[model samples]
Target: MAARSALAILAALSLAIGGCASQEQPATQPSPGGSATSGTTIKEGLKIAFLPKQVNNPYFDTSDNKGGKPAVEEFKGAYSQTGPSEASPSAQVSYINTLSQQGTDVIVVSANDKDAICGALTEARQAGAKVVTYDSDTNPTCRDLFINQASAEGIAASQIKLISDAVGPDGGEIAILSATANATNQNAWIEMMKTELGKPEYAKLKLVTTVYGDDDDQKSFQEAQGLLASYPNLKGIISPTTVGVAAAARYLSGSEYKGKVQLTGLGTPNQMRAYVKDDTVKSFALWNPADLGYLAAYAGAALASGLITGKEGETFTAGKLGEYTVGKDGTVLLGDPFVFDKGNIDTFDF
Candidate 1:
């Protein structure tokens, strides 16, 4: 991981000196709210800012500090992260506005709401900031590209498989504990999970209900408690956000349902390690949050450097992670979700 991080930093730095910009909105740039023109060029010495759903989040912290910082440092791109402490669209808007006012080159974000931030993102793009969404995404027209941590189906399937394996093939009643209702990735994965549950192999795994934690720790804990109280027959849960899963683990760890109700979802190894050890959780899934940030930084650098336009069939290399081609709708799949269990959990630290 260290080597990979270093490699990312070096790669981004190497490209920092080569970009060129135009006097008018570059040929590749959209005329604000319009589709991007392919082959448009951007300038180098990119100034980058990361506005996550909120500040002080452990997941974002790992990704930005460990992953993004190194890459930005290498490229000599001036990097900063500032956002509202609470995950709200309004809060993010304020930060986005400030970054634009400060003339940031690329604005990397994890949007709280897809449409809510579009206005601010548009303003930033008009101000010449390349908008890149990672983790959670803004509406497609609102950003230049999205860095998806994993395929929605793959993530949904992994979560369901973990919970099903924990509870058994018979599949007792289960529920989804998700982030914000409008969170792009969360909503997409939940929908996919619902569709997957309708399949024949998952016939016995009944989905009783779904709940939202708003990605707040206290709220997620309370929501977990509510799920237990509201659905006594529920046998398993899937929390697809780091904050929600850890909070759910905290709520279940001390309760009588600790071992009785299975909990599995996307979580950082550090945050869920104790829960896994103490039997509050069986197994969970997630990509490396740090790598997600690293990838996003590289993608942003590529866009700012004009290495590849955010167009289908455009390919660029991400440090350590290797080459990735832009897919439809300007999306890049980061790969698969990794399962962490008691046996192998000890092998990972991030």
Candidate 2:
């Protein structure tokens, strides 16, 4: 993992060096929302701000500080992070307005609501800031690019598979404890999870219900408790949010359901390691959040640099993560989710 981080930093630095010497050329692809510049060199001192769903959240801290901060440093850009402490539909609107007013060149965000922040984001773009949404996204028209951790189908399938494996041949009731109801990414994944459950292979598994945790630890803990109490026959749980998963693990670890009930979802290794070791969780999945933010920073820089416009087939390099293409809907996929269990959970720190 340390080597991976070192390589990522080195790659960003290499991009910076290459940008300085690259010759200018006309953009081959046309942009939808704006025109692409011929400049190949990434501009230094560009003010890049990360507006996550919440401030001081552990997941965002790792993504913004460890991932985004280093990428900005590599590109010689000023970096900052600001947002609400709680994840809510309109919590990020004020921060977006502030960043726009402050003349930020790039605004990387994980939106809480798809449309709630679109107006503020559009205003920022009109003010000349490049909007790049990651982790979660806003309506496509608002952002220049979206850095998706993985495909919604892939993430949903992985979680369903994990829970199915844990529940065994005679699958019973299962429930999802997700983030806020309005979270775009979470809602997308949940819908796909429902689709996956419809398949014949998973016919034995029945989805009991889903509850919202709002990405709050205490609320998620209580929600997990509620789910168990309300559905005493529940056999498994899937929490696709880091906060919800960790909180659910904590609740299950101290209760009678520790080994009897299966738990799996998107979680950082640091938060799920104990649960895995204690037999409270079988396995969970997530892409490296740090890499997700690193890629977002690079994508934002690319937009700001005019290296590539946010158009289908547009390509740009993302440090150690290598080259990426802008797929449909102005989105770049980071990769697939990785499952962590007791066997290899110890190898990761974040």
Candidate 3:
């Protein structure tokens, strides 16, 4: 029954995204110096690479090192990974430039800023590289396809439910811990969360403030500490980014308010395990990071192989993850977020 409902949710999201934003850079163009037609496919021996928001961030590390690299290897495609040490749009532009110059067949990225990297991405597309945006997205015109983990409405509602359940019916003051101010996915989810709060049942729950951690571990830790000191009456916190959630968890676990203030948001099992065991967090949520990357690699492969041209209703197979079809706006659905608590936290390792 649970499995059935999850599939239904995914189906709904897949249908809804057609009307949403997901512009592929441009349709596939024939390889240079070759006779061209709509049927012409790019050459084999595809070289694929991924550039995430940051290199050392644990969340991206799991996606790239543990998940993405393995999938690329399974398909026998040449694969490489690169990104900035700290996440910023300008910091990623140079990496994009290098990948484009290297003539990588496909470049997968989790955009730091939607528009900041557009010029570089556009240049890469012009250089014959297919762009796939995952985790976060670049502008629709800047990528070939976007691998969305889950629907923003679904993730936001789940976060609201977790905090509401932990804080109880009477409700209380709450705040949000988020990623960079301009993070496309982060901002979209936050907006949905605010809309969720407008429901009558949540009238008593007051949103005290929202803070940014820039997806930095130390900065997020400090931001969590500050929220505690500033909002003495704060009842709960919702952190929608993996980095922010884990860092906030680190701060709340050892603090005096450990059990007093509830924490819930999107996080990986490895990062939130200790907090769940210690009772600092009852529940948090996320999709499988490895699966997210695995699907993305397959999508990049499909584009580079000319199996699909980023058209709605085009289908392709991702090893182990089964088959996926391109939806409206060149969007592909990964899956829904799963909640992790002490009960199920022990079951997942990434």
The most accurate candidate by TM-score is: 2
Candidate 2 at 39: error in angstroms? 1.8
Q: On residues 1-350, what C-alpha lDDT tens digit does candidate 2 reach at each position?
A: 11234345434334433342132232222333345666655678989999999988888998898788877877788999999999988889999999999999999999999999999999999999999999999999999999998899989999999999999999999999999999999999999999999999999999989999999999999999999999999999999999999999999999999899999999988888999998999899988788788889888988988877798877776665666788899989887777788887776766
Estimated TM-score per prediction?
A: 0.87, 0.90, 0.88
Specify the poorest-scoring 10-residue window by lDDT in model 2: 20-29
**Residue 143 alpha-carbon offset, candidate 3, angstroms:** 0.5
By lDDT, the better pick of 1 and 2 is 2
What is the C-alpha lDDT profile of model 1 across 29-97, one tens digit per residue? Answer: 222222334433334468888888988999999778767766676555777888889877677888889
Model 3 alpha-carbon drift over 4 Å, by segment: 1-44
Instruction: Give the candidate order by descending TM-score.
Output: 2, 3, 1
Per residue, candidate 3 scores C-alpha lDDT tens digits across 1-350 of 01225555444333222211122122233323222234533334678899999998878777776667766666667878998999887899999999999999999999988999999999999999999999898889899999988878888999998999999988999999999998999988999999999999899899989999999989999999999999999999999999999999899888899999999999988888999999999999988777678778878877887767787767766665556767778788887787778886776666
- Report the C-alpha displacement of residue 308, candidate 2, in angstroms: 1.5
Task: Report lDDT (Cα) of residue 254, candidate 3.
Answer: 87
lDDT value, candidate 3, whole model: 0.82
lDDT of 1: 0.81
Please list the residue runs of candidate 2 whose C-alpha ends up more than 4 Å from where it truly belongs after superposition: 1-37
Least well predicted 10-residue stretch by lDDT in candidate 1: 17-26
The lDDT values for all models are 0.81, 0.86, 0.82
Q: Which stretch of 10 consecutive residues in model 3 shows the poorest summed lDDT?
A: 18-27
Model 2: residue 100 alpha-carbon error in angstroms:
0.4
Report lDDT (Cα) of residue 236, candidate 2.
98
